[model samples]
Target: MTTTDAVRPTGPGLGAVLSDAELAAVRADFPLLGRTVRGGRPLVYLDSAATSQKPSVVLEAEVDFYEQRNAAVHRGAHQLAEEATEAFEAAREAVAAFVGAGAGEIVWTPGATAAINLVAYAFSNATAGRGGAAAEPFRLVPGDEIVVTAAEHHANLVPWQELCARTGAVLRWFGVTDDGRLDLSNLDEVITERTRVVAFAHVSNVTGAVAPVAELLAAARRVGAYTVLDACQSVPNLPVDLPALGVDFAAFSGHKLLGPTGVGALYGRRELLEAMPPVTTGGSMVEVVTMEATTYAPPPQRFEAGTQMVAQAVGMGVAAQWLGELGMEAVAAHERELAAELVKIAEIPGVRVIGPVDTADRLAVVSFVVDGVHAHDVGQVLDDRGIAVRVGHHCAQPLHRRFGVAATARASASVYTTADEIIAFREALAGVRAFFGVD
Candidate 1:
């Protein structure tokens, strides 16, 4: 696919609920979606919340970057280097626009986990007086509280734990209700004056529950705490506007957004990013350097040190543009239908949904447990029928513990998922207990 072809996918039309024909056409854009698994049974990919499949345009963009114009960005005056830099920066603008952030506020990282680590370590750097006066506000004193939630993936939760360890700050969290919703009835109590940083998932990876962003943000604001959103789930499935949501920082991965792996983004407010100190050092991020000392670059570059994921970033930019053309309203609307269908698995005797059973304020990701049967066994039964799903804690062990379960089998949908596939999943799931002799 050429540059022009990359922008125009033969998928669904913009900003409307996709018809059956439109969904079929959209699924065709993803080559892997058509393939079969486990002895020619048609693939029913329902693990999108774990990672999304890439479309042809995203694949082509990466190939084009390497094949046509591959060079080290922000170096060299030659044509290849200049073009590479342009493509790389253009990708940044595309991603920033997709999430309603400024281009300067978006910094490239290895993944959402690394992006969160960057902020955490940057805060650690500030506590050590790296950025001097400007970094003062970011510094954490002993007994200061850093709040997360009981439903966070390890990527969102562990970094804060490590940061609290490093800075002598206390780690705190909001609990999850029995129905898998965030227990924010005590929001003010959790986000008290001592809270210096408040980080939580925009969507629970295990529960498929959307966090109350407005209320959470307001609570953080009232306490003058920095808000960091782990948008790894929400950004891909829902339309997100970081600026409008007013989070001080947000992180999401490329692979989760129908783009390639090895690239992710950190969205920060312009002023906050500028004030934050660098975590990774050396190479392009530096503005000036001496044998004895070095001064760093601006907000993004200052944080983005060393060689970058140039091709992957380019692919991510194309993906953002492709999804934009498809219209997020349509993508979200389609997934909401899938979410409702997935919930019906609970109707199967001895089967239980671990998350919300209704379609209200959730994505298509659903985790469920089978009575008297292990989650891995349930996954194997589905896999035998050419259905793919995630098994285990889904990286939110605390939430799993809260629910009194060890693990669960998760079926998550994407924009291309079909109602027929959901029917197949439910049929397969209904037989799990029978196969295990637990019916």
Candidate 2:
């Protein structure tokens, strides 16, 4: 376990160049990759699952807002307000196009967690008969079941757990296999006649296993259940189409896709979002307010209450455009190459990759445990060399329990990750055992 060979370089293996030219150039736009850390150690950032580094385009979009049109959006007759509102809505359109969704189908929230919570809260209100007409489709009773998975991050799991607790609905979940894929063989039992809502992650955060969305959706559809997908991990890395995925609702974070933090989107079918009750009430969401009753606006605006994250949304829109320019298929292909190389490193002696070994069906978010060493110590060793990775259970305690470990060391890749960086990460990991005198 001595430090020797590094992880393989993420670029083309040998003399030949990568076919994706735009992806090669994408590294230049992220300013952070240019900097050195830990007294001149070249920075290797592989924690895109937590938050992606911003490209210049996204940064400039936010800066442009502050400089040229720093005014409130949607609630203004003034010149600056009009300008701001136009830019904001343009951003919204950009996001909608990125996901193959309509402007009305998208609602901005604080982040993925908030977006998911908004839906959950709305569903809760609907079930309780508290949201008036909007509550019609969401009413679940005592025998109703909400389906989730052991692999879901807390954002997707906790809300439903709370919803079930509040509504007296039964909660059922798919378990995780040893390789970290969801055990969906019991789909019939897990999503039964009692299931009113079915929610799960598109790709597991800890395992990187891409769930069988088509099959999962079909099972839910068979049971007449509403589907909610947590796309926080997948949306940033892959080409996501909600209409194609056939989910009733989807949520993702902007920060994980190189946009600023504090903004994310919830994508619900136009009719579904319109029928769902507003979780937060006040301000622009309302169309008409009387002393006794108030009527809310339509879909996107109705879900978006209070002040909006104009700058964040604008930045996210730019991020989406930037990714679109590169082509999502190319992005997916580039990362698959990186994952293939990184998986080789995990196969080395004393390394145990946490997820499915199949590269074709996974994201680049690989987690693993190194023999004779704690993940925290390994993370510190890599951090000392300026290689950033995520370490721990990754907010999926049930998943970790299935793996028979409390925590793991994760190395996630983005469009910017190079083969050399992955190599350096592996080399650093090889040194961990020796650094701690464990070998």
Q: Output the number of the lDDT-best candidate.
A: 1
Cα lDDT of model 2 by residue, 95-213, tens digit: 88989999889999999999999988998888878668767879878879999999999999999999999898988999988887889889898988899999999999898999999
Compose the digit string of candidate 1's lDDT tens values, residues 1-439: 3333447544455557888877887888899998999999999999999999999889989998999989999989999999999999999999999999989999999999999999999999999999989999999999999999999999998999999999999999999888899999998888999999999999999989999999999999998999999999999988899999899999999999999999999999999999999999989999889999999899799988888999999999988888887888889989888899999988999988987898899889999999999999999999999999999998889989998999999999998899899999999999889998987
**Every candidate's lDDT:** 0.91, 0.86
TM-score of each: 0.98, 0.95
What local lDDT does model 2 show for residue 40?
98
Error of 2 at 397 (Å): 1.1
For model 2, the stretches where C-alpha displacement exceeds 4 angstroms are 1-21
